[model samples]
Target: MTAYTATVTVRLKRGVLDPEAETTKRALSRLGFELEGLRSTDRYEVDLDAESADAAAARAEEMAERLLANPTIHDYEVSVEER
Candidate 1:
Protein backbone atom coordinates (compact mmCIF):
# COMPACT_ATOMS: atom_id res chain seq x y z
CA MET A 1 0.00 0.00 0.00
CA THR A 2 1.12 3.54 -0.71
CA ALA A 3 0.49 6.56 1.50
CA TYR A 4 -1.97 9.07 0.11
CA THR A 5 -3.96 12.11 1.05
CA ALA A 6 -7.50 12.66 -0.07
CA THR A 7 -9.20 16.02 -0.08
CA VAL A 8 -12.96 16.29 -0.06
CA THR A 9 -14.70 19.58 -0.60
CA VAL A 10 -18.40 19.88 0.20
CA ARG A 11 -20.59 22.76 -0.83
CA LEU A 12 -24.28 23.52 -0.94
CA LYS A 13 -26.11 22.86 -4.17
CA ARG A 14 -27.47 25.65 -6.32
CA GLY A 15 -30.78 27.03 -4.96
CA VAL A 16 -29.99 25.71 -1.53
CA LEU A 17 -30.08 28.00 1.48
CA ASP A 18 -26.67 28.73 3.04
CA PRO A 19 -26.95 31.03 6.01
CA GLU A 20 -23.26 30.90 6.77
CA ALA A 21 -22.29 32.00 3.30
CA GLU A 22 -24.89 34.73 3.38
CA THR A 23 -23.52 36.06 6.62
CA THR A 24 -19.98 35.98 5.28
CA LYS A 25 -21.06 37.76 2.12
CA ARG A 26 -22.67 40.49 4.12
CA ALA A 27 -19.54 40.85 6.18
CA LEU A 28 -17.40 41.05 3.05
CA SER A 29 -19.69 43.72 1.60
CA ARG A 30 -19.27 45.74 4.78
CA LEU A 31 -15.53 45.42 4.27
CA GLY A 32 -15.95 46.83 0.73
CA PHE A 33 -15.49 43.60 -1.20
CA GLU A 34 -17.65 43.51 -4.31
CA LEU A 35 -19.03 40.25 -5.54
CA GLU A 36 -22.10 39.11 -7.36
CA GLY A 37 -22.45 36.03 -5.17
CA LEU A 38 -20.72 33.90 -2.58
CA ARG A 39 -20.77 30.35 -1.30
CA SER A 40 -19.23 28.48 1.59
CA THR A 41 -17.65 25.06 1.56
CA ASP A 42 -16.28 22.48 3.94
CA ARG A 43 -13.01 20.71 3.22
CA TYR A 44 -11.80 17.48 4.76
CA GLU A 45 -8.40 15.89 4.29
CA VAL A 46 -7.87 12.22 4.98
CA ASP A 47 -4.58 10.42 5.13
CA LEU A 48 -4.64 6.74 4.38
CA ASP A 49 -2.90 3.88 2.65
CA ALA A 50 -4.21 2.67 -0.70
CA GLU A 51 -2.97 0.64 -3.58
CA SER A 52 -3.23 3.53 -6.02
CA ALA A 53 -4.44 7.11 -6.40
CA ASP A 54 -7.66 5.87 -7.93
CA ALA A 55 -8.35 3.76 -4.89
CA ALA A 56 -7.68 6.67 -2.57
CA ALA A 57 -10.03 8.90 -4.54
CA ALA A 58 -12.72 6.25 -4.53
CA ARG A 59 -12.51 5.90 -0.79
CA ALA A 60 -12.70 9.62 -0.32
CA GLU A 61 -15.65 9.92 -2.62
CA GLU A 62 -17.42 7.27 -0.62
CA MET A 63 -16.65 9.12 2.56
CA ALA A 64 -18.14 12.28 1.11
CA GLU A 65 -21.25 10.52 -0.11
CA ARG A 66 -21.78 8.68 3.13
CA LEU A 67 -20.95 11.26 5.79
CA LEU A 68 -19.06 14.41 4.82
CA ALA A 69 -21.84 15.78 2.67
CA ASN A 70 -25.61 15.67 2.46
CA PRO A 71 -26.52 14.25 -0.93
CA THR A 72 -29.87 16.00 -1.02
CA ILE A 73 -28.46 19.47 -0.50
CA HIS A 74 -24.75 19.37 -1.16
CA ASP A 75 -22.26 18.50 -3.85
CA TYR A 76 -18.78 17.21 -3.19
CA GLU A 77 -15.52 16.64 -5.06
CA VAL A 78 -12.73 14.30 -4.11
CA SER A 79 -9.05 14.57 -5.01
CA VAL A 80 -6.14 12.39 -4.06
CA GLU A 81 -2.37 12.86 -4.07
CA GLU A 82 0.65 10.90 -3.04
CA ARG A 83 1.86 11.48 0.47
Candidate 2:
Protein backbone atom coordinates (compact mmCIF):
# COMPACT_ATOMS: atom_id res chain seq x y z
CA MET A 1 0.00 0.00 0.00
CA THR A 2 1.07 3.55 -0.70
CA ALA A 3 0.85 6.31 1.85
CA TYR A 4 -1.66 8.96 0.93
CA THR A 5 -3.38 12.03 2.30
CA ALA A 6 -7.00 12.77 1.61
CA THR A 7 -8.53 16.19 2.01
CA VAL A 8 -12.23 16.66 2.47
CA THR A 9 -13.88 20.04 2.32
CA VAL A 10 -17.44 20.45 3.60
CA ARG A 11 -19.71 23.43 3.13
CA LEU A 12 -23.36 24.30 3.36
CA LYS A 13 -25.56 24.10 0.26
CA ARG A 14 -26.33 27.30 -1.62
CA GLY A 15 -29.80 27.73 -0.16
CA VAL A 16 -28.95 26.53 3.32
CA LEU A 17 -28.63 28.81 6.33
CA ASP A 18 -25.11 29.26 7.68
CA PRO A 19 -25.14 31.36 10.81
CA GLU A 20 -21.41 31.11 11.37
CA ALA A 21 -20.60 32.33 7.92
CA GLU A 22 -23.15 35.07 8.14
CA THR A 23 -21.68 36.31 11.40
CA THR A 24 -18.21 36.24 9.99
CA LYS A 25 -19.30 38.10 6.89
CA ARG A 26 -20.89 40.78 9.00
CA ALA A 27 -17.71 41.13 11.03
CA LEU A 28 -15.66 41.45 7.87
CA SER A 29 -17.99 44.07 6.45
CA ARG A 30 -17.76 46.04 9.67
CA LEU A 31 -14.00 45.93 9.23
CA GLY A 32 -14.43 47.56 5.80
CA PHE A 33 -13.85 44.52 3.63
CA GLU A 34 -15.90 44.69 0.47
CA LEU A 35 -17.36 41.46 -0.73
CA GLU A 36 -20.42 40.38 -2.59
CA GLY A 37 -20.75 37.15 -0.60
CA LEU A 38 -18.98 34.82 1.74
CA ARG A 39 -19.12 31.23 2.78
CA SER A 40 -17.38 29.08 5.38
CA THR A 41 -16.09 25.55 4.97
CA ASP A 42 -14.60 22.79 7.08
CA ARG A 43 -11.57 20.91 5.91
CA TYR A 44 -10.36 17.54 7.14
CA GLU A 45 -7.17 15.77 6.21
CA VAL A 46 -6.80 12.02 6.61
CA ASP A 47 -3.61 10.03 6.31
CA LEU A 48 -3.97 6.44 5.28
CA ASP A 49 -2.56 3.66 3.17
CA ALA A 50 -4.23 2.83 -0.11
CA GLU A 51 -3.43 0.89 -3.23
CA SER A 52 -3.71 3.93 -5.47
CA ALA A 53 -4.70 7.58 -5.54
CA ASP A 54 -8.15 6.64 -6.82
CA ALA A 55 -8.68 4.37 -3.83
CA ALA A 56 -7.64 7.13 -1.44
CA ALA A 57 -10.01 9.59 -3.01
CA ALA A 58 -12.81 7.06 -2.94
CA ARG A 59 -12.28 6.42 0.74
CA ALA A 60 -12.23 10.11 1.50
CA GLU A 61 -15.39 10.65 -0.51
CA GLU A 62 -17.08 7.93 1.48
CA MET A 63 -15.94 9.53 4.72
CA ALA A 64 -17.38 12.84 3.62
CA GLU A 65 -20.67 11.28 2.60
CA ARG A 66 -20.99 9.21 5.73
CA LEU A 67 -19.81 11.49 8.51
CA LEU A 68 -17.87 14.61 7.61
CA ALA A 69 -20.78 16.20 5.80
CA ASN A 70 -24.53 16.27 6.08
CA PRO A 71 -26.02 15.14 2.79
CA THR A 72 -29.21 17.08 3.24
CA ILE A 73 -27.60 20.45 3.86
CA HIS A 74 -23.95 20.14 2.91
CA ASP A 75 -21.85 19.74 -0.21
CA TYR A 76 -18.43 18.20 -0.03
CA GLU A 77 -15.33 17.70 -2.14
CA VAL A 78 -12.53 15.14 -1.76
CA SER A 79 -8.97 15.23 -3.00
CA VAL A 80 -6.06 12.83 -2.52
CA GLU A 81 -2.30 13.05 -2.93
CA GLU A 82 0.77 11.01 -2.19
CA ARG A 83 2.18 11.62 1.27
Candidate 3:
Protein backbone atom coordinates (compact mmCIF):
# COMPACT_ATOMS: atom_id res chain seq x y z
CA MET A 1 0.00 0.00 0.00
CA THR A 2 1.05 3.54 -0.71
CA ALA A 3 0.57 6.44 1.66
CA TYR A 4 -1.85 9.05 0.39
CA THR A 5 -3.55 12.18 1.54
CA ALA A 6 -7.15 12.88 0.68
CA THR A 7 -8.55 16.37 0.87
CA VAL A 8 -12.30 16.78 1.04
CA THR A 9 -13.97 20.12 0.60
CA VAL A 10 -17.60 20.50 1.70
CA ARG A 11 -19.85 23.41 0.90
CA LEU A 12 -23.49 24.32 0.86
CA LYS A 13 -25.30 23.71 -2.38
CA ARG A 14 -26.14 26.70 -4.51
CA GLY A 15 -29.46 28.34 -3.60
CA VAL A 16 -29.05 27.25 0.00
CA LEU A 17 -29.03 29.90 2.68
CA ASP A 18 -25.56 30.29 4.16
CA PRO A 19 -26.06 32.75 6.98
CA GLU A 20 -22.45 32.62 8.10
CA ALA A 21 -21.14 33.50 4.69
CA GLU A 22 -23.68 36.22 4.32
CA THR A 23 -22.62 37.69 7.65
CA THR A 24 -18.98 37.53 6.64
CA LYS A 25 -19.75 39.23 3.37
CA ARG A 26 -21.56 41.99 5.15
CA ALA A 27 -18.69 42.38 7.55
CA LEU A 28 -16.19 42.57 4.72
CA SER A 29 -18.28 45.14 2.97
CA ARG A 30 -18.38 47.18 6.13
CA LEU A 31 -14.60 46.94 6.16
CA GLY A 32 -14.55 48.41 2.62
CA PHE A 33 -13.86 45.14 0.79
CA GLU A 34 -15.88 44.96 -2.38
CA LEU A 35 -16.95 41.54 -3.48
CA GLU A 36 -19.52 40.09 -5.82
CA GLY A 37 -20.26 37.17 -3.48
CA LEU A 38 -18.90 35.00 -0.71
CA ARG A 39 -19.14 31.37 0.30
CA SER A 40 -17.84 29.11 3.04
CA THR A 41 -16.39 25.64 2.94
CA ASP A 42 -15.08 22.97 5.28
CA ARG A 43 -11.94 21.13 4.32
CA TYR A 44 -10.77 17.85 5.79
CA GLU A 45 -7.43 16.21 5.14
CA VAL A 46 -7.17 12.49 5.71
CA ASP A 47 -3.97 10.48 5.53
CA LEU A 48 -4.09 6.77 4.94
CA ASP A 49 -2.70 3.89 2.93
CA ALA A 50 -4.32 2.86 -0.34
CA GLU A 51 -3.39 0.70 -3.27
CA SER A 52 -3.66 3.61 -5.69
CA ALA A 53 -4.67 7.26 -5.95
CA ASP A 54 -8.03 6.20 -7.39
CA ALA A 55 -8.66 4.00 -4.39
CA ALA A 56 -7.76 6.82 -2.02
CA ALA A 57 -10.09 9.19 -3.85
CA ALA A 58 -12.87 6.63 -3.79
CA ARG A 59 -12.48 6.12 -0.09
CA ALA A 60 -12.45 9.84 0.53
CA GLU A 61 -15.53 10.32 -1.59
CA GLU A 62 -17.31 7.66 0.42
CA MET A 63 -16.29 9.34 3.64
CA ALA A 64 -17.62 12.64 2.37
CA GLU A 65 -20.91 11.14 1.28
CA ARG A 66 -21.34 9.29 4.53
CA LEU A 67 -20.22 11.90 7.02
CA LEU A 68 -18.46 15.02 5.79
CA ALA A 69 -21.31 16.35 3.68
CA ASN A 70 -25.05 16.42 4.18
CA PRO A 71 -26.55 15.03 1.01
CA THR A 72 -29.66 17.14 1.39
CA ILE A 73 -27.85 20.48 1.43
CA HIS A 74 -24.12 20.13 0.92
CA ASP A 75 -21.84 19.16 -1.94
CA TYR A 76 -18.35 17.80 -1.58
CA GLU A 77 -15.29 17.14 -3.67
CA VAL A 78 -12.38 14.83 -2.94
CA SER A 79 -8.82 15.03 -4.15
CA VAL A 80 -5.97 12.65 -3.45
CA GLU A 81 -2.18 12.96 -3.57
CA GLU A 82 0.86 11.04 -2.45
CA ARG A 83 1.71 11.73 1.16
Candidate 4:
Protein backbone atom coordinates (compact mmCIF):
# COMPACT_ATOMS: atom_id res chain seq x y z
CA MET A 1 0.00 0.00 0.00
CA THR A 2 1.14 3.53 -0.71
CA ALA A 3 1.05 6.24 1.93
CA TYR A 4 -1.56 8.82 1.12
CA THR A 5 -2.82 12.11 2.50
CA ALA A 6 -6.49 12.85 2.45
CA THR A 7 -7.81 16.37 2.76
CA VAL A 8 -11.40 16.83 3.78
CA THR A 9 -13.08 20.20 3.74
CA VAL A 10 -16.39 20.81 5.51
CA ARG A 11 -18.54 23.89 5.20
CA LEU A 12 -22.08 24.99 5.87
CA LYS A 13 -24.68 24.77 3.12
CA ARG A 14 -25.69 27.87 1.22
CA GLY A 15 -28.82 28.58 3.25
CA VAL A 16 -27.46 27.39 6.57
CA LEU A 17 -26.60 29.63 9.51
CA ASP A 18 -22.90 30.04 10.30
CA PRO A 19 -22.52 32.06 13.44
CA GLU A 20 -18.76 31.76 13.63
CA ALA A 21 -18.21 33.02 10.11
CA GLU A 22 -20.71 35.77 10.60
CA THR A 23 -18.92 36.90 13.74
CA THR A 24 -15.62 36.84 11.95
CA LYS A 25 -17.01 38.84 9.08
CA ARG A 26 -18.40 41.44 11.46
CA ALA A 27 -15.04 41.71 13.17
CA LEU A 28 -13.28 42.15 9.88
CA SER A 29 -15.71 44.84 8.83
CA ARG A 30 -15.10 46.66 12.09
CA LEU A 31 -11.40 46.54 11.29
CA GLY A 32 -12.14 48.34 7.98
CA PHE A 33 -11.95 45.32 5.69
CA GLU A 34 -14.35 45.52 2.80
CA LEU A 35 -16.09 42.27 1.92
CA GLU A 36 -19.30 41.30 0.20
CA GLY A 37 -19.53 37.99 2.09
CA LEU A 38 -17.52 35.55 4.13
CA ARG A 39 -17.64 31.90 5.08
CA SER A 40 -15.70 29.42 7.18
CA THR A 41 -14.71 25.81 6.70
CA ASP A 42 -13.08 22.96 8.57
CA ARG A 43 -10.17 21.15 6.98
CA TYR A 44 -8.92 17.74 8.02
CA GLU A 45 -5.76 16.08 6.80
CA VAL A 46 -5.58 12.33 7.27
CA ASP A 47 -2.65 10.04 6.62
CA LEU A 48 -3.26 6.43 5.73
CA ASP A 49 -2.22 3.62 3.46
CA ALA A 50 -4.15 3.08 0.27
CA GLU A 51 -3.66 1.40 -3.07
CA SER A 52 -4.17 4.60 -5.01
CA ALA A 53 -5.21 8.22 -4.71
CA ASP A 54 -8.72 7.28 -5.76
CA ALA A 55 -8.99 4.90 -2.83
CA ALA A 56 -7.69 7.53 -0.48
CA ALA A 57 -10.21 10.04 -1.73
CA ALA A 58 -13.02 7.51 -1.40
CA ARG A 59 -12.09 6.78 2.17
CA ALA A 60 -11.93 10.45 2.96
CA GLU A 61 -15.32 11.00 1.37
CA GLU A 62 -16.79 8.30 3.55
CA MET A 63 -15.18 9.84 6.61
CA ALA A 64 -16.65 13.18 5.71
CA GLU A 65 -20.11 11.75 5.20
CA ARG A 66 -20.02 9.81 8.42
CA LEU A 67 -18.49 12.42 10.75
CA LEU A 68 -16.85 15.45 9.22
CA ALA A 69 -20.04 17.00 7.89
CA ASN A 70 -23.73 17.16 8.70
CA PRO A 71 -25.67 16.26 5.61
CA THR A 72 -28.67 18.31 6.64
CA ILE A 73 -26.72 21.53 6.99
CA HIS A 74 -23.23 21.11 5.64
CA ASP A 75 -21.35 20.05 2.50
CA TYR A 76 -17.93 18.51 2.17
CA GLU A 77 -15.24 17.82 -0.42
CA VAL A 78 -12.40 15.34 -0.38
CA SER A 79 -9.01 15.32 -2.07
CA VAL A 80 -6.07 12.96 -1.91
CA GLU A 81 -2.37 13.06 -2.65
CA GLU A 82 0.52 10.64 -2.45
CA ARG A 83 2.57 11.04 0.68
Which candidate number would show the highest TM-score if scored against the true structure?
3
Candidate 1: residue pairs that collide: none
State in Å the error of residue 56, model 4: 1.1
| Whole-model alpha-carbon lDDT for candidate 1 | 0.93
lDDT of 3 by residue, 1-82 (tens): 9999999999999899999999999999999999999999999999989999999999999999889999999989999999
Better of 1 and 4 by lDDT: 1
* Model 4 bad stretches (over 4 Å): none
Q: How would you encode candidate 2's per-residue C-alpha lDDT over 1-83 as one tens digit per residue?
A: 99999999998988999888889999999999998888889999999999999999999998998899999999999988899
Q: The CA-based lDDT of model 4 is what?
A: 0.92
State the lDDT at 38 in candidate 3: 92
Ranking by TM-score: 3, 4, 2, 1
lDDT per model, in order? 0.93, 0.93, 0.96, 0.92
TM-score each candidate: 0.92, 0.92, 0.95, 0.93
Please, what are the lDDT tens digits per residue for candidate 1 over residues 1-83?
99999999999999999998899999999999998898789999999999999999999998998899999999999989999
User: For model 4, which pairs clash?
Assistant: none
In candidate 4, what are the lDDT values of residues 1-83, reduced to their tens digit?
Answer: 99999999998989888999899999999999999999899999999999989988898999998888889998898888888
Candidate 3 yields a Cα-based lDDT of 0.96
What's model 2's overall lDDT? Answer: 0.93
Query: How many angstroms is residue 22 displaced in model 1 relative to the true structure, after the best TM-score fit?
Result: 0.8
Return the TM-score for candidate 1, rounded to 2 decimals.
0.92
